[model samples]
Target chain A: MQKNTFKRKTLPSLAMAGPVSLWMILFVTLPMLYIIYISFMSRGVFGDVVYKFSLESYETLLDSTYFKVILKSIKAAFVTTVLCILIGYPFAYYIAKKPKEVASKLIMLIMIPFWTNSLMRLNSWLLLFQTSGPVNNFLLSTGFIDTPMSFVYTDGLVMVGMITNMLPFAVLPMYSSIEKLSRSLLEASADLGASGRTTFFNITLPLTFPGIFSSIILVFIPSLGIYTVTDMLGGGKVLYIGNIIKNQFGSIRNWPLGAALSVLLIVITGLLIYIYTRFAKIEDMEVL
Target chain B: MSISRKQKGKRRQELLGTIYSVAIYTILYIPVFVMMMFSFNNQRYNYYWNGFTTQWYAKLFNNSAVIGSLWYSVVIAVLATVISVTIGTIGALGLKKYEFRGKKFINNMLYIPIIVPEIVMAVALLIIFIKIGLSLGMGTILIGHCTFCIPYAVVTIKGRISGDGYSLEEASMDLGANRIKTFLNVTLPSIMPGVMSAAFLSFTLSIDDVVMSNMLAGAKNSTLPVLILSMNKTGVTPDVNALTTIMILFIVIAMILNNFIRNALKKRAKMEENI
Candidate 1:
């Protein structure tokens, strides 16, 4: 009777998990395998995949132009990461310090804009900063400049877009970690002879290191591979690593080269994530 | 209790903290402020304040393409949400209750989709759909969405099930209820918050997707984000601003309705508790 009951319970559990498991293996694992496989193949006369194995695609990736693209992408992503950290850390800190009810509401405010498509947000930025846009017109009216500033499609504007897109990803994780900090530690630091400055650098900063590390990883990796923001805001004038990958598939029609670039992206992301895991447990990664 | 020189230094540090806080909030809000202000602008160029007009909003609603694509987006989002939540709830419960092999692998699989670049996932799925000869349309979009959507739903519901209580379900079963009866009477109510939240989240995410929809869309199956993106590529238009205003209006209306219904239910629940 007990064995029958055990079987009954177990059967349902297995049944429940079965379909989702199969879905994952097929859609996720299989595609990942295909990416690796495509990375090894040669490009055909047309855009078709030629089955003959060759390292030509990987070799193409090693070309100096590719290196410059990778370096530029990294530089942009890095600058964006730093700005996000500077902007996000204290915003998170302020929110975390609020009462629970208020904190959630504040978090909602931060996230509400996010609910709108990111592309919409980028378009709005363009509308706001374009030559005839309000900022330029206002500046012109105020006698700040005789000519309208060419803000859109510039490096500065691209950085602005990148930072705006990534700010939320930086804040949410840091907020979770900072919120979990023990009140007594702050109290104890006060109770002792330590000043607020010493306590923060010595205690609070150290405690929040895990969160800071995650903020870096989350912002850096996505900023590296995100071509849409750069493509739209950069006016297709400047290319990030992401734009290059998109070019291969869309305009360049080099699937093997694209696959190789994607493989490189995957490696970079994996290595960073692995490093982040060393600093902060993956299980503790707060989903915003 | 000690206010020594060291404590003075700490107070100074806190002052620095205050400075840091102000600077950060300014950076975060300035762009948002610009966007919010322009939404109310009368002129087509957000750079100039011609005069305040709601004409953009009026024009937005008149756009047949935006309206049609929005309808399609809503249907696909709803379908994807329903499918993902059902599968996710069952999967979360299964993962929570059972000691199964490959649990680790399954857990990692879910995380991979969340962290991997959306463009990469979009391309990979597109290639696979072509390789397998799956017809690209609303169906492909729905399926592609669910592959990532179910993972998020699963992870969320798993956290919810693990927290709080499951004792009610155990007791209900002990009192001679069948498994289905126990679930209907106990498990469903317990996880309803999770279910609602997960559904809300999935709907929001589905509506926001551009890359995946663009990759998998049939010639006829354009979503609002895709339409907006194409229009953007052409150049700025007052129509987009108007369309955006209309979309924002829809979202605000939805939020207000949700709040009203939730408050009514909460009031009823409180009355019952008092009784």
Candidate 2:
């Protein structure tokens, strides 16, 4: 009986799950623990990580410069999330109301830009808004400004890049949720003599809260840690928490400080995800 | 009177919706369209439009560095897709089939990659690699890509496998087919769509990755995106624009082909049911 049970159940289960479990443990879990571990260690004078335990990295985070970047990153991420929602929610609603074939095609349209290299997309933005680029050229000829106004490498442009990069992530989840909403509920609301605006606010918006919540989680977290958009569009001038982390690991070579900042990011992510679980199931997260 | 007023309000709302969608889509696509147009411009600086020419495309083809990095990106993407798909599919199957201890923990573990920011994960992986004396190169890049991609594959495949119950597999087993045969004949076919989509997604992600690849890639092993990052810093040439246009066109064509094949398969399945 034991042999049969092992053969049919335990062995097959192990065969199936063992590889992935081992891979995750070794590659994913262990590395994550190592980051936490190294964050506590001291940085050597030569930019190497020393084995001595110290609280100096955490102390460095308390510096006003790092604190300001963290605040700025949070503000940037918040603004980006809000902008994505304001834009993506209505677009998702529009797509969800379309026929199934049309809705899928619309979704595909959104995804097409995403498939292109993100750096390429950011590059195009640079080309478009560069001092001598089309926008400035048009403005110069039309006499909008005497000389070309500098549009590249600004916080506003960085926000534009962030919105474009994150819009699809925000839209896809909301679209899925809004599509799942039943038409009968809307009709029932209308039949009960509710105004269209009322129906939307009370019925549609509340029902799609989970999607918006997930969208917030998706957009806010990544933008907080995203260096590429700010790096390219901000032109190395605007440093966020993400840029600081990159610098620490890159030019600064402060491994303990980088690891410490990453821990901060991880904590923020864990808190948001914890909040997300309170609102909805994690499995229902619409990543695509 | 009330009905006409209501109809007008509804019409106005729809018109607004249509206009909003059109404006949003234009915002999304304008940069891409502009990039494609400038790829053919005779101007090297891409400031003002000069006469159209294909010279940039020609130059891109001859650029060995761009071509080599692209090749490396493809190779890594393919390898990562294969590894993640195999591990993820099997793991999902195991979780679905067995009532095992620590199943919840394993499932939660899958969400870690999806939840955590890429920069943190990249730095984490880099630290561990340095600690273990593992040199950064294509090998480290592959590990990084697989680490993230596996969670996506697992989630996607699990959704498909769990949606359709195991009745067909059970029936096949009852008819004296062995477990391996049952899986091959029944379970695999049902999940093939999910598997294919997961593979495509994993490929796109690996190819498009910038943050992790930047950290994990050594000097000589930069992927296309990492290469593009460097190129941008040194002043982007028109050839990069040409390359971007080509990549966008290829992906669009591939997506359309995938959609076409899926529709045809669905039609054939419907006809089979009718017969």
Candidate 3:
């Protein structure tokens, strides 16, 4: 009887879980391990990865040129995250206060642009801000400037691109959190003679801290590793860690160095995730 | 007089909120709006509006490269969605229903694909492919997509299944139905909505992927986004704009339909519970 029950339960479970487990292990786990493994390996003269294990890539990362790029990427990512919160929080709060039907529609509106091809959106920014593009043309016609200012390839425009791409991700988590805030808590605080500012600071903000943190993780990490925005909007002029990693794999062909950079990103991700897990359950991450 | 003053203050706050929301929405949408509007603009470059025409839409069909890459993207999305949904649903059910060791480890592993940056995942996959001597192409792209997509599928399906207890399944089993039969009749139907949405999400993620697709795509076999990325370097014509606008419309309509169907199903389920 015990053997029969074991066969019935465990066999089916194994049959169900085995394929996916193997798939994840092979595709996700193996690749991740390979990245870490290769990072410690040395680079060859011809830009291929040499099998000999070395700390050369880690040493190369400490070089001032690469160090500056990492610092710049972090700065860019930090500014983007802060900006996303500042912009998204109000919008999320407003939506959360609305009736259910209206709130859903508002959320849908936020989502529509996200579903559109992102590269095309980046391209639109390029066209709209090109030296002879519409913004410049409009300004020139209004006699705002003598010449069209070059806007297509600048850090400012790249920042704009980054913010737009990451805004929806930032808003969704905060919206869900804000929406989940119980109204009675705020009402009770108000009844207790708390000022509106006091109620918000003491009650609402703390309640919504998980959402805010999730937004930071979602926005900051992607912005750090994003190269396409900088590549297009900055016109290859802006260099970030993401661009450096891409070039290492592409033009430079330094596989070990690229792997090391990726390891750094993974470490940053792991650290943020660790911090996030302390505040909120991993499952509570508002992925949608 | 004081009550009216408070009411006035509330009204002003509401108005400010409305204005802020509208401004943010406008900023969110302006670029895509510009892209959509330019698809109808009869111009070589999207700098100025010459005249409104749908010629770009017509030309888009004739652009073999666009159509071909689009075909590849659709194929990859479909395959990835189907594969991930099946494996994910099964995995979620097994993990949820049965006691198992290493469950926590598997659960943690699922988050890696979702939380890791796309560039990191792309390069990691690229490195592994090169190391394993697997040539980069559609197969590798499919593998990369499924790796990320399965976790999302599992999470989504897990949410649906975890909400309801196992009483119904137990009842079905006690009535002499085998486990497979119980799953077929009870478990699967309950999670249909989750499965459908997972498929939708996976499809969208697979199709819109540029980073992974670009890295995995070798000399041939470019997905639509990868093709578009390459075009950005050359010049993005109006046809690409037309294609993007069409995709935007298709996704919006699909989302509306999905929401409508989901609501209908929820109402039906609620009515059944009442009965």
Candidate 4:
């Protein structure tokens, strides 16, 4: 009877969980281990991985060209993240303060852009800011500049694309966390004669730290890996880490070097995640 | 009283906040608004308005490449969604119910695809596909999408199931219901919304995916986003804009339907409560 109970219980659980476990192990975990393995292998001349092992890919990373590219990628991602925080915080704060129905509707409005293809959106940015595009045309007609300034194919344009791509990510998490803040806390601060600015800094900002952290993680990692923005907006002049990794695989045809770059990207992601774990529960990582 | 002055100051703050929010929202929608307007533009590859025509939309429909890519993307997304939701929902149930040794470790591992960069996954999968002598195609892309999407399904389903699920399941089992019967009658109905949303979310992620498709897609099978990405290199055409506008319309209709269904459910539940 004990064995029967055990059989009934464990069987269903195994039948349920077993397939996914096997799936993850076979597809996800094993592939990642293979990447690490390939990262150590040498690249053949024909754009294939040779079985012989070496650290040439890692060594190549220390070279000045690769170092500069990595730094620039970090800088771009960092700037985009900071700008997202600055832009998104106030927007999220305002949305959270609205009535529930209105807030959900406003959030829906924010999501409209995401429902469309990103390429479409990025292309629109190019068209909007192109030399003879509307923004430039309007500015020139209004005599803001004697000539239509070069707007498209600029680093500034790439930055705009990055911030735009990531702003919704920053906003949603922060908004959810901000909405959860009880009104009584703010009312208590007000009744105590605390200035509004003082209450905001002391009470509100710190309360939403988890959301901010999540936003930072979400925005920073993707921005670091973003290649399309640079490809279209920057006209492929600037090679961020993502573009570099893509090129190594695409045009350069060096599998090991690309794998090494992938390994580095993973390390950077892992480090940030480790730091994140120190601050918040892993479950607190917001999907939206 | 000082109350009037405080209220006046508060009003000013609110006004400023309102203005700031409007400006942000405008910037966010500016691109889409431009695309919508441009899709009607008579000029080819022209951002400036020469005249309004739906030529781009007409051309977009006639483009076999766009249509084929769209069909491929939808089919792949559906397959990926079905596999991920089934596997993920089951995984969520198992993890939530059992006290396994590696439970904590597995939960942490679930965040990997969420946390690890997509490019890394793409490269890793590309290598694996090649090493295993599997030619990259729709199948490879499907597997690639499934890898990341499963985590999302797991997260979404787990959240739904973890809420009062243990109590509900135990209560059902306490009755004469067998395990399968309990799941079918009690748990499935309750979690149906979560599962549906999970399906939708996975579909969106898979359909919108560019990186994995770019890597895993073969010479013959290019998804819409992958096609669009390549087109962007040569500068995107207005037909692409038209295609995007149609996609946006579909999304809007879906969201509206979802909202109506949810409201109806809420109303029915409220009526039941009153009864």
Residue by residue across A1-288, what tens digits does model 4's lDDT show? 988967977777788878777777777788888989988999887887788989989998889999899989999999999999999999999999999999999998998888788877888898889877898889999999998889887789999889988999999999999999999999999899998899999999999999999999999999988887887688878679889888887878888888898888889988988898898987887864
Residues B6-124, candidate 1, lDDT per residue (tens digit)?
67876786688768766755655555455555666776545455667777667766878878888888898999999999988888888777767898898889887778777777777
TM-score of chain A, model 2? 0.97
Model 4 chain A, poorest ten-residue lDDT window?
A: A5-14
Global lDDT for candidate 3? 0.90
Put down candidate 1 lDDT per residue, A1-288, tens digits, no spaces: 988976786688678888788889988889888988888998888888998899999998779999889898889999999989988887888789878998887787776667556776787678778888877889999998999989989889888889988998999989988999999999999789786689989998999989988888889888988877876788888798777877777767888888888888888878988887776677677654
**Per-model C-alpha lDDT, please?**
0.81, 0.90, 0.90, 0.87
Interface DockQ per candidate: 0.51, 0.76, 0.73, 0.69
lDDT of 2 by residue, B1-275 (tens): 98899899889989999999999999999878977888898986776677889999888888998889999999999999999999988888988888788778778878888889999999999989988899999999999999999989988898888555688988999999998898889898889888988898899999999999999998777898998887766556788889889989998887789779988989999999999
The list of candidate 1 runs beyond 4 A from truth reads A1-10, B1-52, B163-166, B256-275
Candidate 3: fraction of native contacts reproduced? 0.71
Candidate 1 chain A: minimum summed lDDT over ten consecutive residues — where?
A108-117
Q: Model 2: iRMSD? A: 1.2
Candidate 1 has a DockQ of 0.51
TM-score of 1: 0.91
- Candidate 3 chain A weakest ten by summed lDDT: A228-237
Pairs that clash in candidate 2: none
